[model samples]
Target: MSLSPSTFETIVPSRYITFTFPNHHHHHHHHLRVAVLDSPSAATAAASTAAIWVPPGRESDWIFSTFSGHLQLLLTQPLSRLILIGNSPSSPQPISYNSSLHPSSPTPLQRNLAPLLSALTPKSAFLDDGEIPEVPLLVFEDEVVKSSIVEICEGPCVGEMLIENVELENDGVKEFRRRLRFKRMPNFVQSQMRICPKNVTSFENLDNMKFELDRGVLVQPYLNPMVAGISVISRFLEGRTFRPKALCLGVGGGALLGFLRVQLNFEVVGVEEDEVVLEVAKRYFGLEDDELIHLFAEDGIEYVQNLAKNLSEECRFDAIMVDLDSSDVSVGACAPPTEFVRKSVLLAVRAILHEEGVVVTNTIPSSKLLYERLICEFREVFEELYEIDAGNGENFVLIATKSKVRNALEANEGAFLNKLKSVVSGSYIDSIRKIPRTADPAF
Candidate 1:
């Protein structure tokens, strides 16, 4: 809808319409721009050349033109992949304008478009079959089309669309091409920082990912459900008489460790097996190496087994927060060596967990209506279990506690949620406060 100040103008087909046009009432401002490239090298300086922003639903809106006069770009459909040729759309004739042609002359442009018109041309590597190029496209409120062009999401990926590739004269003038790449603004994280009013939500996206990756800052990335779940865990630990000692399984971005270490001042130890995960958490998410926050790289199951065997009653932990999702082999703690998930692994965890301590876990169920086997087993182990519906999808934050929460259980859902708001921190605190009364299909 809006272009940045740095941009000056767009070349549109004569038939195309834009609000800036005199008859603004007939069309809206949302526009689609297309570019054709002769070669990678020729694509440079695309901005100076004219471009048009095509408004949807008008035939006159899409008029391919002779821009740059060097390259002709053809599109059979609305551009998922491009078939580039050196010949003009008007004629099927071959034009081989080699490197010797100067910019002022039309020879170079004609040459690039001429030879490669056929798919079988040797030089036509640009039009390779089975090549799915990640392209940039904008889909705002207004659009008139069945579905849309391939690949457009605000986050979790990045790409650029190439419009022009300049193939210089035979002597090799500086090669150039024009590409449009878009960066996703961290609006969700930034806006949260401004309004959340709590330091916990200020984890990975606390700053731009580029900056966080640069500094390797130890902050949790803002996962909506994960954030709320962590807050609920923190609230549960708030009432402990002793300083809470927390164990985090599967260091997801190391956000939980950061929160427990800085926000709750808990004696924290984070266990993660994947070397790449720890490396990325440290390098990109700013996971810190400090005395208060310790990280161990080993198989989560073996580590727990070792802890259960070695530690005495005095060494039990106040809270164990398990967030191992990616696999279903073992839900409570990463794939729980199949033998352990049956009972031993959980019993081992319970052995080291203090009598009044709590275990909080994030489990992705097989179905929203179906309860997971691990949580079902957890009910068999712990005396009191509370389930919080994350409201995102099938994410369930199950709280299994050693101490009885009669007060919380006695109070109706509304009263319990009111108590939760008072106990937890951040906007997400409210989201996880929604505790489910009954299991949809108790396994």
Candidate 2:
């Protein structure tokens, strides 16, 4: 029963749901979207689990830094319904009885939250043993999710449920207010906030990493994968007769933002949705709100979508480097990576890409299913694709380019290598050299 690829259709229906903390005046787009094809899909699960904080508290820091402690799934992976169990008006309304994700329904997903209390309750001494647990806030079709201020921790991410002790507060409302607390090491905090070079011990490198306000820019080695992705892009551009225009997504620490502007001299634009993040970048990362590097506080997906729909051809880039981190180096791939690397986003990338241009993304290949899906989706959009392994294969840099150099198309291997050498030199030179100039498909 072999079926033709063109004739085949997806049997598994997919669901795309978005969640976020309530919006503020300056940051209105505070939403995170997750797409789930089915349970057990690594990429889908990763994206859904990307951002759940235990609320920031001084007491929560000890548990987060512990070697190993309690762990639990924040939300159901392949999330069908988002339940906020609370009396608050801002909470999402419960899902109707007929909806597929309803826990009371006779569906496989109904079993997801059967033991909700036990699953969310982490074994920690901070909790009161006699305190009865009640559903304070549940925002979903099935039930209400209790609302709690999650503290961002800094340490290991065991993926285990280790909640700090819960203190049930009597808000004098009809139902008891459940102030839940959970914690995990903030995954990309250091990568985004700190500027460290490869050789941190050397005094000269340390000095180079320092940033003073309104002066020279700062960068971090945490962006090694992006560095590699950009190098591959530069090599491709150098083989051609045209210059490179670069775009960077996620201005968390402005590592790539600084590198592209100062080192490579590419006309660069950095897009970040978080004003708080952008403010931090300006204050700490030596990033200035200036004309040379255009900074936009908007969602990357919607930004690119609008750029393609509204903007003219002249606004496109020769090189686009996206660092909306798709994986936790310690845990594996997550949903944001899935969102960023999906067919739609990749196609949007292709829409704005120069016929001779390239786009690169940061990912972790440690997760087999996520890694394979990434390569597969990338190939669906670009003419040629390449990857560079970083941190001894911990991080994977995906380079997808619609354009190919004349030498490469003509099978002139030696000339192609020479051109790559010329485009990249210094610290970046060694990393790009580690990856073969050709794809594994070339075999």
Candidate 3:
């Protein structure tokens, strides 16, 4: 039953559906043309997925296989509309396929796409019309292609690496070993990755990881809010502007570091525990440790402790950003590992910070108790504490300051917006608008 690759025809019966939805300003309409293929084969899926849109550039192959499976399912059942959204709106939408309905039958997709788009499109005036729409298309003839399920990256990757580890529980030590892949899917212009566990055999296990866009673009929504938190520090140092120094504890891909050094005119010190990650960052993510940016391969907590013990005016940082997250899934809180947030560590961090310095950390609290506990722990050391809700509900950026930033949010709101205007470009400014209007719950 062996079949030649050439025996399969790549062409599938594809139906093109064209619809118009009002643009964000409602001044014009955006014509969305989706090609619906009937019963796409593996070759067609791969070709279509690669050609139409990429869910995550690094995991492009896996997404294609998964997409192929769903398309196969469409042969038997009526599935919802498949909407593959790219990170940016201007990025092309992936092709959708529907086989259950006749071409003349007006499916739910045609009926509801407009209303759904209107509701999901962000109301923010600053966001480009290209930003990812926040809604979903209705059910189509067969199969549901989830919206916003994958991370987008700028690509045409040149190199890739697969790091594998095996788990064997022994000697009172257990390793949660799986697969870790480092894909240098670079635009030569930009960078990103695709990682997943070796144990991930099905769609269920694949839930743990996704593709990531590297330093060139802040593909992660939370990163924008994280950058916005720095505006509080910038506003605090206004008029007395000296070259600000920033310390980044967990420099994953060095995206924040690149942003700080190249975009914001700041000297950055990045400390990453994983040497492999550091190398990947340099080789794949465009992280370079030049005069303006210094990279350290060491323990973040110990580094802070050493900085505290050898405290010097020259070593003090204007802003300290802790972006640590635990690899151990069993650990409830994902950011800062429990040790980084300890009172002693916080004190050491404060010791190495300039008087007007600010500390920002990305925290994903697994429980209500942990979240309240973190807020309480931070309030004890810093005179001012604020939270930038990333809107995802689970992720938050905690901004803590040494000096009492009286009404920091209200006082610096305008300044923060103005600062964003100066620092970020149009394509990325949507992140600024992503900042919750009611951010900085505490004054």
Candidate 4:
């Protein structure tokens, strides 16, 4: 029976027992603590699943619910962890409950259980009715309670087995023949596998193949060796003094390093925030020590800030390239807040750039909002801005230059294309060039 609104208890157990609500402002501070509380009889039964609800405005509720849900669903037999269900007023979404019975009409509680739902097994079924089943279920609504379930899965499987089940009929064989015919086209290299049937009859023309595999041919795109920090230091004073230096803010593994080194030949300095990535670059990527190359382990913005303060007036970098975060686009409702990007990071970048220097940013193609915001911020600091569209799926590079790039298309076009070719390689550069460039200022 539904409880009357007047008599219903407004207080519910908190999803996070250690931290309080809304005031826990720092996103990084709220830790999700989950505890599995099973029924006395099922104490030995693995607690596999858990559900949590978060209210609006309470930071702890959101943190616990989302993170705990991820942890619970990742465990094997997560259904056993079905321990506690708690609520908070700060939650914007309804709470999700796990039940094998009544799969369609599960009751919507005033809590956020999205984290658990995300971690739930793809095969796991849910009960539709509002009522908690005879199966173990925990329900609470508050900001200070840690909810969890018992662990069931022992360890993750080391490797996955590949199972291919192909059933080819007469029509499928005919289609395969057609594919083989297409592969015989002049443009199609015979070394590229032609579709063939499993039967011996399909090998009739195998001896006619003339092409050998070209080991020298690079099929994949060129990758930067220095993933993060990329800087170009120009020389003056008859090769004795340093002139304008350019730094690439957040390079990934020095994919851009090859281009800057070969084309500009400027003293390149790369800074990376992740220590593990830096080590990986050194070990796997061909990053070497030289007079032009310097590496540092530091955050991009912090490094720039320090450089701005310490570097001599003539020693400041003339250009800076930035590519931070894995994907250019931000997804989901719980994406990192906008303030962090607009204020903290972007502002710091502008603060460090030289007045006459340029800041080139590589961003995801689909993230229009982020691109616009970046342009707006750059416009505030620099007078000239140009963007190069590397096509869809490929990343776009924005060149925010202080020096009015004289006849950008004519002057820098050759250098830009050559740099792109050297860094990205032959076939990759061709593919990138196939994508048209748009000069829309809004982009």
Q: Which digits, one per residue and each the tens of the lDDT, describe model 1 over residues 1-443?
A: 85342222222221122222122222443222233332232322322222222222221111222221112221112221232121122222111122222232333323333321222111222335845222222211121121111112222222211111112222433222111112111101111011111324332221221111212121122333343443433434555575667788777456667756655567788887766556545643457878777888876767888998998765678778776543321121122234445578888878788776677776655444335566567767777666566554445666676655544433324432454344344554543343333553222
Q: After superposition, how far is residue 208 of candidate 4 from its true place, in Å?
A: 31
- Tens digits of lDDT, candidate 2, 1-443: 43233221122212222223222222453332111121223343221222222221211232222211111122233431222211112222111111122233232322233343222222221136655333223322212122222222221222322111111223432121111111232222323322223334533211133222222332233355555454444445555554467788777657667766765666788897666556555644567667678899888877888887876777788878777754332232332455676677777878888777777776644357656666777777777776555543345566777765333322323443344344333344354422233444211
Which candidate order results from sorting by TM-score in descending order? 3, 2, 1, 4
Name the runs in model 3 displaced over 4 angstroms. Answer: 1-216, 411-417, 422-443
lDDT of 4: 0.37
Question: Model 2, residue 30: displacement in angstroms?
Answer: 41
Ranking by lDDT: 3, 2, 1, 4
Candidate 1 structure, TM-score to reference: 0.45
- In angstroms, give how far residue 274 of model 2 lies from its true place: 0.8
Please write out the lDDT profile of model 3 over residues 214-322, one tens digit for every residue: 3334544466667777766656656554678999998766778988887677899999776766776775556798999999988899999998999889899988988
What does the lDDT come to for candidate 2? Answer: 0.44
Q: Each candidate: what lDDT? A: 0.42, 0.44, 0.53, 0.37
State the lDDT at 218 in candidate 4. 22
TM-scores, in order shown? 0.45, 0.50, 0.51, 0.41
Cα lDDT for residue 440, candidate 3: 30
Q: Candidate 2: minimum summed lDDT over ten consecutive residues — where?
A: 93-102
Evaluated at residue 98, the lDDT of candidate 2 is: 16
